[model samples]
Target: MTGKTHIVGGIAASLAYAQIGNHDPLIMLGAGIIGALLPDICHGGSKIGRKLPLLSKLINMLFGHRTLTHSLLFLVIVAWLLNSFIPNEAVKAGILAGMVSHYLLDMATKNGIKLLFPIQMTVRFPLTTKTGSKVESIVFSLLTLVSFYYGFESLGYYL
Candidate 1:
């Protein structure tokens, strides 16, 4: 999935989570955006990679794309770090939700992701689509609709 798709997915996931958890939607929105782009830091061409070139380069050099950063181990480490550093429970939950959404979206792509890392095991949905393809666009659209639904619902705008 592209950066835009990931962003929308994050928004949708975060808003849904916030609504379910009775947390603040606005705060989650920002954290979700950050988390969605976090794993892509391994690819120099990705949005987060472009923003943090030095860190992206170093991570890419050390772990390569969809390796360590995309792994469950990375999520565990992030959870630990967030628990230790971030006092806001909503922010931590939102970020983790967004990252999970990112993983799910990427898993739908043909290239797949190394969910286990170090183990060299790739994980993906049974049916995968090409990044930036029409199918991905459809997924993006669905996520957009979901985002709008959750966004409005959170604000007390039911429809």
Candidate 2:
């Protein structure tokens, strides 16, 4: 999936977290976006990778794309870090949700992700689509709608 789609998914995940946890919308959104982009840091050509080229290149050389970063181990470590250091439960929830959403979306791609890394297992949905294709566009659109709907629902809590 494209970064745009991941971003939308991040926002939607954050909005859901906000609604559930009564979190600060901006903080959740920011953290969620970071979470969503974190996995692709291994891919030097990816959007986040382009921004942080050196680090991305190092990661790409070391672990390669869709390896450690896309794995459940990575998510567990992130969640552990968030839970250990971040006192704000809502922000932590938002980030975790965003990260999980990233993996879930990637699972829909033709090249499935290694959800359980080091275990040598790739997980994917039955309906796989190519990245940057029409199916991805539809996914992006649907995520946008979900983001708006949940964002409004989150705002309702403020009102």
Q: How far is candidate 1 from the true structure (C-alpha RMSD, Å)?
A: 1.8
- Residue ranges of candidate 1 with Cα displaced over 4 Å: 157-159
39-138: candidate 1 lDDT, tens digit per residue: 9999999999999999999999999999899999999999999999999988998899889999999999988999998999899999999999999999
lDDT per model vs. reference: 0.93, 0.88
Segments in model 2 whose C-alpha atoms lie over 4 Å from true places: none
What tens digits encode model 2's per-residue C-alpha lDDT throughout 60-93?
A: 8988888899999999999999888999877788
Q: For model 2, name the residue pairs that clash.
A: none
- Lowest-scoring 10 consecutive residues by lDDT in candidate 2? 150-159
- The global Cα lDDT (0 to 1) of model 2 is 0.88
Clashes of each: 0, 0
